[model samples]
Target: MTVLKNCRLLPSLTEGYDQPTGDIIIEGKHIQRICPPGTAPTDSGTTIDVKGATVLPGFFDLHAHLMFANQDYNASVLRSQNEYMLDSMEYARVYLKHGYTTIRDCGNDFYVGVSIKNAIERGIIQGARIITSGKIISPIAKGNKSFGTLYEEVDRPEDMMRVCRNEVVHGVDFIKYMITGAVLNESGEPGEMVTTPAEIQAIVEAADSLHTYVAAHCHGTEGIKQAIIHGVRTIEHASYLDDECIELLVKHGCRSSLVPTLSIAFSLFNHFFEGTILPEFMEKAKDACEHVIEGMKMADAAGITIGWGTDFDRENFEKYVGLEFTSRAKTGLPNEAILRQATINSAKIVGLEEKLGTVKCGKYADLAVVDGKPDEDLTVMKKLPLYVLKEGVLVAGTALQQEKSYE
Candidate 1:
């Protein structure tokens, strides 16, 4: 048993916890009790004094490509398989150390995400809890030689169903399907619809049968509406969402949430030069960056659920993940709302709300203790956590000393 004492707890936006400063008792992997500071039973368990740091639920990233390196699509493909896997594991540690305790890998090539997920579960590595969508499913375009190994390409509804089932059989936590072209796909435009409604529905149905959900990679307003209409669980990178698309999202009860990956667009537009990325791609990235913030404002106004996602690779992971807080703040979202998106809202997106995302009793003891109040200034998250805990075990920080007295 372990006890964290004298920490300020962030109130849950979804489930409220009244106390501001408290002691959290962890029995095994779950939080057993939470009480005012100095009130926890002190007879036997170890205690660590947090010294008034603000404690929050461990952060979650709804859309991440864990196996992809931060290189151009062509260059990323040339990496050896072993190098890719090792880098993925290293990236996992990077994310965890930065305060994200859980991540949902949107897509990956060669089932590397599944392998990494299994390794983490088996205690072979120290990293974030990973939920993986084995490989992305997309429509095969004829003569599209630029298509890499990242996708399982299919055209027919029946083919979509087959791939969905295969991914489920391979132990995927969810299924990811492309409803439109990607910014990085050289053969198509980002806003162009690539899959038919029937195909998307088939994929959704297949995932539903196995009790999992589908996350659609949609950038255009038309594709966003199609995905919502067909029951996709979350719309990723809703870059061009408009009023009608926002209405469809709200009407559908946001069982299909929106995950606007502003970080990718922001990274591409500001950090890269003309020749580093295709000029057309850079142009689209600029457009996406503007449209995403506008869409976020509209979605917030319409009360549509929005979750945090970076869609970034290893090289930009540290630089971009926390920048999401600043980006959304530009959309006029309150810092508290942004915190909820990263914690509770994201947990709901991946269907892990009850077990994760809040610092209440009975939830998993995954949390980050920051040196300042993030509820007021989210930029504080850009700093390494003062203390980080996953399943009640200290994974980062030097907060605890062997002989430090709790009193």
Candidate 2:
């Protein structure tokens, strides 16, 4: 057992915690007790004097491409699987350092995320608890093909199902389907919807039988509505969700993961604002941002569940939660609501609520400790966690004395 005394806990939910300044006793991998400060037992296995730090549940990033970012950025021209894995390892380490104990890897290249998830589970490296959606299913020249790599070509439902089953067999937690075009396509414009409703239904059915959720990468209004009707668990990059699409999502219980990667937007819009970005890219970027803001406002007003996911990093590697929080706030979502999106709500979206995402007893002992209350000043949310605890064992910072290093 481990006892963390003098902590102000922010329990993911907006409701106030039972113990604002109390003690949390963790036994094995679960929180065993939360009591008034002085009531904690001193004879436990480990005792931490938090000095009244704010302890919130570890954050969760619902949509991310794990091995794509570093591969894209670090690769001078081209990269092999072996080279990609090397770069992915660095991302995994940084992911843990950034206070994301758990993440849903939306898509990846070279099947690296599948291997990384295994490596972490087998204690090969220190990384986040990853739920993966291996290669995305989309039409030719549509999905991962845009990256010039990581493409998986499928032409039939059987082919799609076979690949989906193969991904599950390879230990994927979910399947990704690119139902629409991307904003950054090189074809002078984001093309039309690529995957048909029948194809989407096939992918959904395949995942359903395997008991995994499907995350659809879509941008167009019709594509978004189709993905929702077909029952995708979460919609990523909803850059153009019209009222009809929003209503369908709500009517069908669809959730959205808003990836407001303003950094990328700013990158694409650099020319318009500072006359640096290419003029053509500026219009595309402006349209994407405008649609994204409109979609976010619609989602927020409709009371649909939403979470943070940024298609920011190369290889869709991990990112700091603080930056994600700040970027999401620009989408018109309140900072406090965004916090829940990062934690409990994100957890629920990815089907990991039972294991991670909150400070409740019986949940994983994933904790993020900061110097101040995140509930107040969300800007300081990513201040290097003073300490990180996973499964009741301190894993970073001063907590390292009790941590088991994977290195």
Candidate 3:
């Protein structure tokens, strides 16, 4: 048993605990009870006073690529495969340290993600609760392999079910398909639809047969509409979303969500004139950067279910990982609503709402402690959390900052 004493609760992010200050009791991996401050028996368990700092449920990232060796496209492919595994493990630990206790890793090769997820479950590795996808499924286009690629190649729609079944057999939790080209791929056009409607149907059908859902990497307006019409559950990086796309999401009744990735766009704008970026890559990056935030604003306005994601890579991880908070705040939405995207909304997206999103009893004891109230100032998230706990085990601490900056 463990008791978190004198903790300030964020009402917006909590349920079952309504008091402004209270103590949370933990038994094994679940929050056992909530009582008024100092009312619980402190007889036999460890007790930690959080010194009145605010405690919130740990955050989530519905879209994260956990196995990249570096931020560069070429480096991710050219680096030694052994080194990639090491880096990916370290990335998981570091991300947990940043207060994200749950993540759905978008893709990796060799089933590395599923392997590490099993490792974490076995207590051999310290990291988040990982839900992962197998190798990216993409068409045999130059964009999928301009330099070198980790994607599993396919051409005809007939091959989709077989490829998806192979990934499921290898232990992936879900299917990730490329509905449109990526900006970082040198030979690809970012907003152009590359996968046909038949391909989408095939992948979705395959995933449904396996009792899972499909998450698509989409950026173009037309492709976004196609994905919604075809029953894609989660849309990653809907950077070009428009009115018709919003209408389709509302009309479908399928509860499809928009996961806008603001980190990539913010990173592009941050490093636009660095001179190391290629000209073609810069052009596509510019297009995605220009419209993603506005797209998020538009989708939010239409009562669309907007979830949280930060398409972070190694290079910009530190600089822009938490930029999603400030970026969503720019949509003129309340700070509380923006915070919910990373918590409850994301939980609903992954179908884990009752188990993970709030600071309530009977839920897993996954949480983060910070000095400031994140509800009032979302930028406070940029700092590494003061204390992070995953399933009642304290995983990260020891970093303290009197001052921190975006630079």
Candidate 4:
């Protein structure tokens, strides 16, 4: 058993943030009890005094590509599969050190994600809990082939089911379908729709049969609408969402939540605006940045569930993850709401809400303790977590070593 004494709990749907000082008791991997400070049972156990640090549920990134090492798309294609897998282990450590306890990798090449996840589960690697889509399914095109192993190409709608089943056979947690082009694809434009609604529906049906969900990589308004109508579980990078698309999302019960990777757009814009990035990529970045902010504002107003994602590669992971908070703040969301987007909302996006989101009793004891109050100063997260606990074990930061108790 482990006891975390004297910590300030973040507000959740069930409990107020300022309710009172408390202690969290952990047995095995789950939280055993939460009670007022000094009221916990005094028994033989490992106790860590948090010294009144502010504690929040561990952060989650719903949309990520763990194998990509940098921003150069072409370079990613040429890199060897072994190299990508090796680099990803380091990337996982960086995320955990920064307070993200869980991540859903949107896509990867050569089934590296599956291997990495299995390694972590077996205790061979110390990293964030990973949920991955083995590889992305897209239409056969010159542009898609340029990505090499990153995408699995299918020419017909019927092929969608076959490829989805293949991904499940390889042990994927979900399916990823390309409904529209990407910002980094020079031969393809982001606003152009690629996968038809029928194709999307086929993929959804295949995933449903396997008891999993599909996440669509959509940017154009039409593609976004089609994905919602076809029951895609999450729409990644909905940069061109308009009024019609917003209405369809809300009317569909918002079951298909939105994970707006505003950090990628802003990151590209900063580089392109300053002439550091290529002009072609810069033009696409400018358009994406402008449209995504508008879409996010509309979605927020319509009560759509919005989650957080950075779409960052290993080289930029630590630098960019926290910026999602500021990007959403620019959309007029309060600090507390933005924090929840990274925590609770993201948990729901990945279908782990009941076990992972809040720091409540009976949930997994995944948490980050910060030195400052995040409710007031959102930037405090830019600093690494003061302490991190995954499954009630001290994975990072400072904690006292267990000492033998003697009477």
Candidate 5:
């Protein structure tokens, strides 16, 4: 047993430990008890003072591309079985450092996610719990090529089903389908809806049979409706959503994982004059930003469930969690609501509601130790966690003198 002493247990947005001080007792991989401070459960074998830090459930990234980064360069490609193992080890660690103990790897190279999940379960990697969707199944098009093309195409109902079912048979936790074209299409216009509703229906049927879920990559209203109507659990980017589409989403009890890929837009704007970006690219970026901004406002007004997701990494990877969280916090909503979006709501999106997202008895011991009170200032989320615990294991320690850094 392990005891996290003197911590403020923030269970969720509307729920928290009533007592001012308490100890989080961990037995094996689950939280066994939450007792008052100074009262260590008799079976406790390890003790660590949280120093009055706020202890909350570990964050979850509902939308993530594990292998898209490698598409830019083959130096770090993990398509090979051996390379996949080595690369996943590092990927898992980076995700854990950000206090995300659970992640849904939407897409990856060479089924890296499948391999990584296996390794993590077998005690090979030290990182977050992974829910990966093998390679994204897209339409057959130029964008489908891995290297020269920016997208991976997989059109045609037969092929889409074949590949999607193959992923399921391969033991993917979930299935991802690209219903619409991406924002970065070389033509500058959002790619046209590729798969038909019938096609999506096929994959959805397959996922349903396996008792899993489908996460659709949709930026257009048509594709969004198709995904929702076909029973996809979540929509990746509802940038083109309209009132009708929003209502459909609400009606079907589906949620959206807004990547707010502001970094992508910012990147385009930053490099507009470099001639490396196309005029159409700039236009698409502008359209995405405007549409997403308006869409978010509408969704918020409609009380639609919104989960925070930033498709940012490396060069523009804003490591400061607060910086990312602030984007939603400033949306004229309460900070606690934003926190819940990041924690509880996100967990619900990925089908992990029962296991994680909130601090409670019998849940995985994944948690984050933050410096300041998040209730007062959501920006403190930008502060690097004081300590991070994954499944009852202390993976990081507070370095008081170190400055909080963004990824």
Candidate 6:
């Protein structure tokens, strides 16, 4: 048990935290209660004085690839299996240190995500809670095989179910399937819909049988409707959305979250604009920015929940993961709305709102104490958290914790 005294709560993250400063009572791994400062008995556990700090729920990144070591697509095949697995283990610590206590790894090479998830659970490592999918499920295509075991290619539409179930057998939390081609693929259509409705249904059925869900990787409007209708739980990178696409998403009640990865698109375009990237990738990035921003506004206007995720390389994780928040602000959303997109809204998208998102009683005591009011100043997000707590325990931070033990 731990008592975080003099804590400040963000209104959006907590339901009834009316006080200017309160004490969070954490027993075991859950938040037992929140009370007025110095009101709770102090002779029960360790108490930390945090009077001026702002307490917010730990951030969530719903779309991530823990094993992507290469930011450059063409040269990605250079790394080995062992290298990816080892680097991923180290990257988990990075996520926790940066105040992201929970992350849904969108895809991975073969089994790294699952292996690392289990390792964390078994106490073999100290890291963020990892929700994982197996190798990416894609149709048979030349470019799909370029990333080694990162992709599990389906030879025919009928094979989709088997591929999805195979991932379940390997102990995945859910399935990640691709419905459209990507800009980085060496030999494939970037925006074309590759799978039929039947294929989508088959994958959905397989995930449903396991009592899980499917996350569809989509960058265009062609298959977003079918994927949502067929029950893809989350839509990754719906970069190019049309009126019909937005309509269908709302018509379906927006049950599926639209995770527009702005960091990757802006990163690519910025590098190209600065003459760092090759000529071939310039046009695609430019075209992606125009459509992605437009789609984001349309979704926001329609009241659709926009899940947050940053799609970037492993080596550049620290440098670019924080960019997603600022990039989201550039889309015209206020700082409060942008912060919600990363916290409560994201937890709702993954169906774990009851346990993970807020600083309420009975929820996990995963939290970050920042130096300023995030809702007023968005750039504060880019800075390291002063202190991070996971499951009622101090895990990582730079400041000295002046903890007092009660006898």
Q: How accurate locally, in lDDT, is each candidate?
A: 0.82, 0.69, 0.82, 0.81, 0.68, 0.80
lDDT of prediction 4: 0.81
Residues 99-131, candidate 4, lDDT per residue (tens digit)? 889988998888888999999999999999999
- Candidate 2's C-alpha runs over 4 A off are 11-17, 69-77, 142-149, 188-191, 255-283, 314-321, 398-407
lDDT: which is higher, 2 or 3? Answer: 3
For model 1, the stretches where C-alpha displacement exceeds 4 angstroms are 13-16, 41-43, 142-147, 272-275, 398-407
Per-residue lDDT over 225-322 for candidate 5, one digit per residue giving the tens place of the 0 to 100 score: 78778887777766787898778877876544444444354455445224543466677766766676677777777887777565544323433344
Please give the TM-score that candidate 4 achieves against the real structure: 0.92
Give every collision pair in model 1.
none
Residue 69 CA error for candidate 6 (Å)?
2.8
For each candidate, give its TM-score against the true structure: 0.93, 0.86, 0.94, 0.92, 0.85, 0.93
Give per-residue CA lDDT, model 6, range 90-140, as digits (tens): 877788877888889988875888999999889899888999998888887
* Pairwise TM-score winner, candidates 2 and 6: 6
How high a TM-score does candidate 5 get?
0.85
lDDT of 6 at 10: 75
lDDT by residue for model 2 over 1-407, one digit each (tens)? 78888988764441224646788889898887778898899874768788888887887766666664432332422667777677666666666666778777777776778888889889878887777777766678632444545556676776767878888887878888777766555443442577788888888888888888788877777877777887887877777878897778767755544443444554454442344223556677778776777777788788877776755564323333466665566766666677777788777776677877778767788988777766777777656677788777676754455554322
For residue 122, model 4's alpha carbon misses the true position, in angstroms, by: 1.6
Q: Flag clash pairs in model 3.
A: none
Indicate which candidate wins on TM-score: 3
Q: How does candidate 5 score on lDDT?
A: 0.68
Q: Name the weakest run of 10 consecutive residues (lDDT summed) in model 4.
A: 398-407
RMSD over all Cα atoms, model 2: 3.8
Lowest lDDT block of 10, candidate 6:
398-407
